[model samples]
Target: MPVLRVHLDSDRSTARRVLQLHQEGKIHHESREAAREQVWRRGHTPAGDPTFVGITNGRRHVQLLYDVEVYSDTVL
Candidate 1:
């Protein structure tokens, strides 16, 4: 955690997606591990609610926290 710094990508598109997910029950308040995996697997995670992004400070890859979650019923 010491090497990682999270700066949320606040875009209108991302926020709009989050709102839609919430309304459609696509977003879930799940564990951070899954959220982490989703972002870590891809350099940039899916943007929704709290958007995802990665910043590398030299050799260190910043791990962004997914404050919101998506449903498991459907594949993201």
Candidate 2:
């Protein structure tokens, strides 16, 4: 089955940090609301700005949009 992907667009360092947090299971976003809230957190970027989030629903539709698996069956 396909999953929802939410990516926080930022500089290389910030992207790496977010990716690390996601991989380590520190961030758990199982819905669109949760993903928007968590992904656009303060201090996510060097200038203390909310990171830009790019979301997509499926895998076959896009080749480069989805980067992180942030949603699950329990959607809000």
Candidate 3:
């Protein structure tokens, strides 16, 4: 499996967008802290870069976290 290393864009607009995605249930993490912790614990390797960070349910659901954007992945 390839690790998706997420890099967050620390800007106002991006924050708003992330919040919106969370509200819409596009982002499964209950909070940014949880997301951060998960990433930290998983350790950012294999992905080798922050631009491709993501977390998955080990099934069909995957969310890709890119700079200033969040994408819901339908295909693994």
> TM-score winner among the candidates?
2
- Relative to the true structure, how large is the alpha-carbon lDDT of every model? 0.41, 0.37, 0.42
Clashing residue pairs in candidate 1 are: none
Q: Which ten residues in a row have the lowest lDDT in candidate 2?
A: 42-51
What overall lDDT, based on C-alpha atoms, would model 2 receive against the true structure? 0.37
Error of 2 at 54 (Å): 10
CA error at residue 1 for candidate 1, angstroms: 17
Candidate 2 per-residue C-alpha lDDT over 1-76 given as tens digits, one digit per residue, 9 for 90 to 100: 2233444333444444544665675542333233455434521212122222433334334211223333234333
Runs off by more than 4 Å, candidate 1 = 1-7, 28-76
Displacement of the residue 10 alpha carbon in candidate 1, Å: 3.1
lDDT ranking from best to worst? 3, 1, 2
Shift in Å, residue 5, candidate 1 = 12
Clashing pairs in 2: none
The deviation in Å at residue 15 for candidate 3 is 0.1
Count of backbone clashes, every candidate in sequence:
0, 0, 5
**TM-score versus the correct structure, for each prediction:** 0.27, 0.30, 0.28
